[model samples]
Target chain A: MLKNLAAKAIVPVGLTVTGFVIVCSILLYSYVKQDLVADSIQREVLLGDIIVKATRFSMLTDQRESLRQTINDIGEQKGVEHVRIFNKKGVIMFSSNDEEVNQLVDMSAPGCIECHSGPVTAVHLGPMDQARNFVNAQGEPVLAITTPIYNEPNCSNGGCHFHAPDEKILGTLDIGMSQAPLLKSLATLRVRLVIFCLMVLVLTVGGVIALLQRNVLLPVRQLVYFADQVSRGNLEINEPEGTEELVSLAGNFKRLARRNLEADDSLRDLQDKLDTLTRQIREREIGHKSGN
Target chain B: MGFLRNVRRPPDTPNRAETAAAPGRERIRRLHRLAYRGLWGMAAFLALSLVAFNHGWLLPPISDGARAVLGKAPPTNLISIALVVYSFSALVLILSRMSTGQGKYKGWSHLAYLGAFYVFYHYGNALDANFWAVFAAGLTIMALEHYQMWTFCTEAIRKEEERLAQAERLEKFKS
Candidate 1:
């Protein structure tokens, strides 16, 4: 029956296990999401650094076209959303998207908030400062990394171009990478985690029910059947065999049955003896009466 | 009928002391029965409380009292305390029922005490690594004692009863 002890016991255990599994799955999903975001930021930052390093020589030689070509080539790579070179005035000097070049960028955007948020005029770029995530114009997720190009002594002291020695930073190279692929993969992982949790819950409940049937329900049912037989005065019925505890209980019942049958036999014998003695005494009295 | 016809009536007799003691003995027996039932009831209550507390299914006043005693949050699996209380109550019940004259029941009482103690110890320290070893040792000792008592009661006592019955039957035939 659905209302049996096995069902009752298994329901609580199943609920506990399922709850634990769901909690663990949620924790795992959060951890994985954080790790994925961190990994993506690190990769994009490294890419920005490489782009800056590759274009430094061209910028030093004043080969503007070659520098722009290098930025454009890197931007065209798989997962690369956009790459741009910007001046200290927040002006886009070069860009993978040509239309955006020569346009002034908004300094208050999410990508620039890390550097512009403080009273300190000069922002010291660190590894963490180089990367950020924001929603693009199309509502797609984008990872933007800003790598600063420092003014070197060679550029300031060179004969071709005049530069100020006090200029701490020359420009910033901004690289934006698409997060669509990473998001898709994470979505797949989430789905898989949900499926896995459901499977684990099902398996746990099913296994518990099976074990309860084997270890408890079957033995208890057998004992109940044996008890019914005993109650009906079937003393000759064989004992039910089961697990060690059940076997011991059955053995005790069988011994009790045997004892009861022995007692019944003894009582019957005593009653027969008393009956014969009473008949003999009755006959003796009748004979004596007749003689008198 | 013949037996009653042949029997002679004895003189009417009364014992004031026996009459005075009868009520006292009856009262003591009633008290014993009540005590046994009360102990079992306490054990049942303890079990129900344990379940209620662990599952957060307690009534308002009892829940408030539990929270006040054990703090706002208590461990959910406190079945061990319930088990210990139940076992101790059963042990006391068995001991109360045992008498000096009933040798069989006395052995049973001792066995019950040991068994209850073993249950308490085993469940109380169920999280321990040495649970199986301790349980095995207690079970072995209890089983040996049980076998000895059972053998004495069944074999020796049954043989003596048979001997007495045979003697009685022989005397009846001679008479």
Candidate 2:
């Protein structure tokens, strides 16, 4: 059923082109998503780190009220879910919300699990590792970054503070941001990619099919008609138009037919000569018999 | 009994052409059938797998190893690796084409293509997307190419058979 040139050539090529486009689109979409999400994570990590740095002086000077107010102000920004500083013991020393000032955070929580789940706490973590994604109580997606506040010589040697230098991590500055914008961007990207994929499929598949029809199928059909005419004893045929290869084949076919025609004409002439000779010989034999 | 005794017996041995062509023809036929079946199977699987994975109807086993490896490497690196492997696979396929026999050394080509699948799977895991799209595309190309080659062989064999039949007919006419 699929033995025709169009079916044999166009179908497979069209399908392969479509598949190729789809595969490429999937990979491209994936790469784009990865890049965008990675950028978002990096941005959140950088913001969290900057907030920690800004609050360092306030913490060193024992300005808890000022630090709390600063956290509250940062948290109040659009898309900023919450900002807080928690001590090493998981106690919320200062938070944007006053009611959660001294609350103990669960060590097993999504944001804390990266560092605290291991047998030994991980002091250093990559930006991706430090970032966590979760849905908050309000059922909105939030991305949180936890930056560790490392103890430095200045903090221990400062005149107002008396902390041992042996203490490595003092606390963690955790920041949560609503992921509405990122999600929205990703959703838009997905829709765009799907549309682009469909567009590519149609264009490529249609192009392939059209090319095959013109360059392959049309010429093949012409040749088939030419061959049928020749088979039905119609030696004269118009040259089929087609690709170079097919046109060359038609040329060869036409030449063969011409040769056959020439051969047939010569054979007919020879047959006529032989018939005349035989008739002349028979007449001569009859005359000889009658004259004798 | 006299009529049965007068019955002439034909030769039991097959002709050289038949013997030579029979096995090769059968092999090509089998390959063509496989290609046809595999093409449809790949198409169906690709569609179902993509939809299933996308809708979370079919969840792959939870494995973080692929995720970790994919996350650490940039997309460029992953793509580069896939491209290198794909080039190697394409070279193998070309070499197979250059060889005299159809479907020769196909196992090596298959093995080479499997390397590409590994990269696809890694990316899929990392992105939580369906890798079957890539896999099925590759399989479809391979199967189609095989089908085309085998079809050509089938046509050649059919022509050869016709020529042999013509010769046999001429031989019978001479007697």
DockQ of each: 0.02, 0.27
Best by lDDT: 2
Docking class of 1: incorrect
The digit string of per-residue lDDT tens for model 2 on A1-292 reads: 6677666655555555565555666666667766777898999989988898898899889888899889989988999988888999999988877788899999998889999887999899999998888898899999889999999888899888678899899999999889998889878887887788778777876777798888887889899999778766687678797789998888788778878878989999999999999999999999999999
Model 1, A226-247: lDDT tens digits are 9888766787777777789998
RMSD over all Cα atoms, model 1? 18.4
Please, what are the lDDT tens digits per residue for candidate 2 over residues B10-38? 87897655565576567656655644553
Candidate 2 regions off by >4 Å?
A: A15-21, A57-66, A97-100, A117-120, A152-166, A223-248, A277-292, B1-80, B91-101, B105-142, B145-175
lDDT, candidate 1, equals 0.64
What is candidate 2's CAPRI-style docking category based on DockQ? acceptable
